[model samples]
Target chain A: MIKDSTIKRSKVTLSNKYKNIYEKRFSSPLKRRLAVLKASSSIVSLGKYVILFGLSFIILYPIIQQLAVALRAPEDINNPLVLWIPEKFSFKNFEISMIILDYWNAFKNTFKMSFIVMFLQLFSTSLAGYMLARLRFKGSGIIFALVMFTIIVPQTTIELPLKLSLTNFLNTGVNLLGKSTTLYLFAGLGMGLKSGIFIYLFRQFFRGVPEELEEAAYVDGASPIQVFYKIMLPNAKGVMITVAILAFVWQWNDSYFTSVFVTDANVTLQTLTTKMMGISGNIQSAISQAGVWQLFDQDVTKNPLFTSMILNTSGVIAMLPLLLMYVLLQKKLFTEGIERSGIVG
Target chain B: MISKLKNNISKNTKIKYANDDELLKIERNIKSKLAKYHEKCEKLSAKYIILAKRKQETNKGNVKRIINVSRQIQRINTKIQRLVANLNIVHEKKFIKRSIVYKIKKKFSEIPYNKQKIVWGIIFITPWALGFLLFFLPPILKSFWWSFNDVVPSGTKILVNFVGLKNYIELFTQYVIDNNNIFNVQILLFVQNLAIDLPIILIFSLFIAVLLNTKFKGHQIVKAIFFIPVIYNISIISSTMSKGFGLYLENNTTANILLTTQLTTFLMEIGIGGSFIDIVIGSVERIFMIVNYSGIQILLFIAALQSIPNQLYEAAKVEGATKYETFWKITIPMVTPILLTAAIYTIIDSFARAPIYRFLEYAVTESRYGLASSIAMSYFGINLIIILVVLGSLKGLVFYYDKR
Candidate 1:
């Protein structure tokens, strides 16, 4: 009985102590304000997480929906019972998409084109960026203004005339249209897809690097080229990686430039994006051409939904490689590249 | 001393000293060149001694290198001695006149170092400048010029007929596609939409970037997810998804729900006004597009935030400034430059994907290259005007932090 009483008394004392501390926290105006501020901050952080989660859900919703739609059997596309989860998961969609897209050939061409363009863009844009940032001279302001002009003007504005000119190509009687080399030429000259932005990014990044580093190299008898190679390039890894990934991805997903310059309707050379675009426009005819109609029943093949399902699958397949690359490189990209790219400064 | 020797030589040779100044210049140049050779010889000998010691210690393949280097040093020494003897003979008898090539070279070397840097700068920019001239400039001009002419594509060539302002007149007044869609209306709506969306996108992206910059739980994952839209092919994905799911959603029973419409009607019944509801519904409808479009902007903002030195925040903290105050005072001002960049990027990006592209495409498909060029040129003019306005307004607000 005595032990029980003592335990009860100790419990009451513990409650009393907590009450006293809680009362002390709000006993003064300053303390009360601080407590309220802390609570509000915590609430703000909670709200941030909620907003972030909601937005992330919105961002990822379509991709996940696409994946779900791609996974379902073609027969189940119109099945009212099926919603998110596929009742009969199959690779038939992927197989048919591969056939229609000429998956392997287009993948090879896209990868090669993107890779080469990425490097060429890096070389040309970085050199131009370095010159603009560190190698200022008379009329450089005009050059920079021109660079901004390039960025402002949409590619559509110049597409027709550019095509006409490139068709003749300096009056040399060389048809650069329907050729992959044209894409390479464009990239090597810093005229690739979004090359202006990459140049601007590099310029901002190089500007952020302390001039003392370059000055020291100059004092050591290093030429400007030597300084760029040994000093500036090493310090520019962040921007370079950022530009490389962006350039590669932009080129990979590019349809406008590729459609205009490289992939003529009569040409066999097609990147994945162009192939997807080409097939998507006439999926019904393309399916019959690929002989995918033999595997599916007439009812299924005739369904417009079935065509869309195939198109959706093709879209997923086209972006799957980029998704994989992003998943692999996102960690470094976010942690190293974006944080240090100085794209804004 | 060389000048005196040149004078004596000129007197002895009875040569008119019209170019005697050139002779003195040559002597001075030779002396400087000899000094450079002497310095090189010293450096090579130092290297030779180090290699010889290394050879003795390791007894390795450096002997061949040492012999070759010594021969090089000997050759340089002989060249130097012969130059010195030649200088003595010139001092006694003849004063050689400087050649035209040498004078030209000297003139080139006399260029200021800063001017030399300008030349190197031009060299550095040569590739891109050439690209701009060849690929960018001519096409831009030709397209602008083409807008004023009827361009017919002949075999690998374009046949141009100057059409004056006919294309522009048709485009502005009578150009109608699908029997109802006017180019003027479409472009106006586009600019109106841009005016609405630009600030919304900029503010939303800035908010998200600030939040992402904070150390929160799952920060890395959220950051990664935020950038996924950068790689997303918005046009293809949206078109495909709309084709499939838009149809499905229409057919589904859930399509009748219409929560937003219901809310709008209820608000109207209660008299909350129409324009406010329109804005709310409009932004709500475009939320997805806004998020997608702001991925790169968010990236830029996050970078700008990260680049803000920690000292400002710390100093603010020491001064007992609140978070809101610090954000406004330290963060916003610091990020203003990036804010301008993001704004310009946002404008250009949206313009590229604008619905006026359909009008341009319509023209292309119809083989009206002149009309297409006019459409493109007009769209560009509008874009440039908007950008200039943005720039002019933001010019005073963009605070460039001069780190130097």
Candidate 2:
């Protein structure tokens, strides 16, 4: 039910450089007054930019702090003089975290599940959307309303029943949560994380396309399915990219859904994070069992810094792929996709 | 016979076109006078051209002064003109825009033999609809049903004894386990916190959107910078808030950490009520988180703002409306639809990730499924009521420009 809401949510990249009333209005005036207004407004804008800069710093601060801590050696962390920049940089924490997190396995699992969900949701939501947008039938309104209701009803409300139902399905001596079956099933049904939003997006986008295009296809003897596949899908590339990236990002970052759906270890980054949280509960025991813990000269158990460093490193590792993705594809995802989305309120 | 016919046709033509001889003489006299007048006009134009050139030479020195005087008068007139204020807000009744889906549906319904089209519609929707019916709906209803049952887990089988409203009743009216008020307190506090967070998040996002929407240098970079928090996602916040630096220590002990800003300390020193201070500080501390959450809302607002035709603002300006008046009258009305959309999104987002949800997660972890379902159901019900009320009220305020 995340479909419509997801479209609404998908539309979240703030646009800059709007022509505000004051800026436009103040431009034309008596020469002296105009200059005064210009000077004052520039200064005011300078202040705003400074504030914006400070806010951005605040937003970036946690990641920066994590990076700093992740880089710091135990000794460097202990030093009172060191703050943001670590004096003795180290990759030891990362090394330990990689082994601790089972990075390769977790990465593979995360990618596998995310890609599956992404593709499933991509087809399901769009098809459903196109149907709703173009197809007229009895009870279609009710179906659309129900779809909206699903979006309204938070998943947590049904989390218990969903789990119970799954458990019931698996009661014939199979644990389904440990496999990718559960994720596929849920995601394929347009009930995946924000899948409803994707569907809604497709519907909204399809509706925005002039009826003449589809009608022409219909007059030319193309079936409804052909019209959708041949005409509609090609035109919906913007939304497709938008939804795909959003679904991927959400699935990748998703701890709750992954934690609930995939109970297995290393099934996704989220499940890995969930597992990490569990490990933190009995961290000392887990560490002592590991041979790497013994390699350290000092008793790592005595230091709070060591524990935090490990957590920070894991957090950094979990976030790195997303950060890299953002850096690489932000222009396409944020600018192009968003601009072409045409998502009305 | 041909000549006689021609003669009769000519006579008939002459009779039809009969005109007086005096009329022809007057027409000729007028033509001759027009030629004489043309010659006189040419001579007069030459004399006038010379006179005008002489007049321009004489008056060229005074022209600049007259122009300056007129400009001064115009400026005075502009200055004297009263700027009209939109003192009264116009509550115009607006109709919602008819979506193309509805239009197509109407058209399809009007056509005869639309069974094939209906089948195609059903075929397309069948997959998701089936998924919804089989998977989505049952779980929802099952959860609701479970809320009314006392579920027990046996070795291989589950025992679900029907306990009608006992869990919900015991949750609110009485404390079942050791007379503890934890459930009531937690639920109340969660609701209260939501009440606070909703308006704060909404107003903050709207304000920020307006600020960010303004043109400035490096705006693209600023937008990118602001959107960083959204990229970081919800887990980062939960991790940082719950278990980051000095987390093992008590709450007050973590105050000295770099992540903890001086605003909390300042508020504490000011001696505000303890709970109130905590709420305020919590909100302040998570301002970045709020900004993160508002990324989409800001975009929605910006998009809405962008869609507003420039002519409305220009028209407002021509009527001498102030920026404040223009914003209230034009911008706000134009953006209310998006405002509602964003608000609903914020409500859903916040409720979905609320502390109560965290509590429900804990209950699930502890294998208290029945109790968890009740909590989830109750939270869902309350939020649904709230969303309905909010949307209903806001619906009236939304001015659909398309209708206009």
Candidate 3:
């Protein structure tokens, strides 16, 4: 009976100790600490939104600035009060941008080259990828390694040699460097505009397919060629769309390759933008040559601002189509294609 | 023991029906007959499968999905065929062991499968190989050769003089007319830029990706805003930023208004001094410069983060780990391999896509091809060294899970 009483007493003491600890936890000091933790975490989350929005503003700054400037009259551009909203709204900048960019003609030329190369790269890269993924032949491993090397190596390493040698590659006494067909020729060979990445994507996607169908076709008296055509190619719609859009977008933005191959007379939209980047320096000379020197701004110091204005408009014009394309196809490319294509590594 | 006993009983039944030699003959006949029958069935089923697949393809080009389903169906079909064949197994016919084709195959064993495979492989990659020869090879060789020699342009043809690394010699030894150390300064500045930008971009993207990966509203719109810069051309971005920044700074009153009341200056007034202020302002400026640059890295990090199993986090939480500890210990180790990929991609993208490369190309257009090639080769070499160094260091830390 004494032992049982002691046990009950100890149990009661233990309960009292637990109550004391619980009360201490709910006391002002500890409660303040808990509240601080809660507040800090909420602040962290709020900070994330604040930071994200600020960065977003920085990214949108140029586009927004350009929009404001493009809509402003020339006189209002110099007005100190005119910043975000123009005093007088006008479409003069758009008209000037169109003429400077030679918008329609340059668009036609760029569209032609970009379209042809995009298709060429689509076919050549797909073929290259198919051979590497499906065909098991000796030295296939080595060939694939070379294809990977092509992707890794910078284009600058080869651009000079390519330019130098292509002029005389034909040995037909005609320099092939400046011809429009050269872009197609290069692209058709699987050496153009991120084709290596496309080839890699195709190879990865093809590798994901089970070997059973191809084997069955082979056993059913289908040649390797027939198997690829009838079985493999039809099953590659996702990658086809993915690669096609990628090729088109990349080729459209390509100023480096086109600059090397095409000359001044064949200026595409990208080349035209680059050409106009420094047109402020030549603006005076151009004005003088046109015999209308007095109509333009003769002050050289203010030419840079004029140049910036032109560039802002041209940049907007050049960027608009791609932005539209992205808006249209971003659902497919950004979320679906990126995930399935194994582009993240 | 039970299995052995069962096996012996089956053998005894077969032997009871016939003498031991005839039983052995029957067993051999059954084995060969079953093999031949299965082979024929396999070929027939393969034909059926091909027909079914072709029909399915015509019905709908389902791509990757249909193949998996059809493969499953084929598996079931084969199993049923095997079970039916076992019920009515037949005797074997005489096998052709010494056909003329076999004899010829033996004679040509030296050429063998390897040779035929080589031929087919060559056929498969013929277009790329041919193109590489026609277009890629000559230029690559010429670039290397041109770096050592002098290229002089004539009316119709060019003169190539073998100067034995004279171009490289002049590049390194000859001082520019200006007192400034031009090449090294540019190289150092580029390296500094990379060193500054690469880590900041990587860490910033990783941070943003973590935030975005959380269950938040409007993440998609924010992500689209961040990625819009990627869709915009790099040249355009650089040009716009440079020219726009120039214009912004040209307005003295506005510049003073923006800079004096900036976040960095406010932080400075609050006792954040020394290099912290510089770093803060520098990062802000770089964030503006390379805001779009982090899009792909963010996407990649998000992918890697999502790929990490949730159970790991649950386990870590149960173990009383803090969020910071969980990130460092669990998230980082899991995403290290992906980090390496992003690093390599960033290195390549930064190296090749720099706006400064336009100046290098400008040199080539102005008939300074030899000097331009030398400069390019030098920078390319430096880029290679940098890549190798990054790979060597990071590869050690990367936790590559053996996917097999």
Q: Which candidate is the best by TM-score?
A: 1
lDDT of 2 by residue, B9-93 (tens): 8775443221445445444554565556455546655655555566588753455555554555454334323111111111111
Model 2 spans with C-alpha error above 4 angstroms: A1-29, A170-175, A210-223, A266-271, A299-301, B1-116, B175-181, B241-282, B309-326, B357-368
RMSD of 1: 13.7
Tens-place lDDT digits, model 3, residues B8-67: 988754432344565456557656766665676577667557766776777645455546
The candidate, 1 or 2, that scores higher on TM-score is 1
Better of 1 and 3 by lDDT: 1
Model 3 residue runs over 4 Å out of place are A1-41, A130-138, A170-174, A201-242, A264-307, B1-124, B175-181, B244-280, B303-326, B353-369
For candidate 2, the lDDT comes to 0.72
Q: Write the per-residue lDDT of candidate 3 for residues A109-159, one digit (tens) a residue.
A: 767777898899988988888888877675678888788667776788788
Candidate 1, pairs of clashing residues? none
Candidate 3 clashing pairs, residues 3+ apart or interchain: none
Kindly report, for each predicted structure in the order presented, the TM-score of its chain A compared with the true chain A. Answer: 0.93, 0.83, 0.75
Q: Each model's number of backbone clashes?
A: 0, 6, 0
Candidates sorted on DockQ, descending? 1, 3, 2
lDDT of 1 at A262: 84
Task: Give iRMSD, candidate 1.
Answer: 1.7
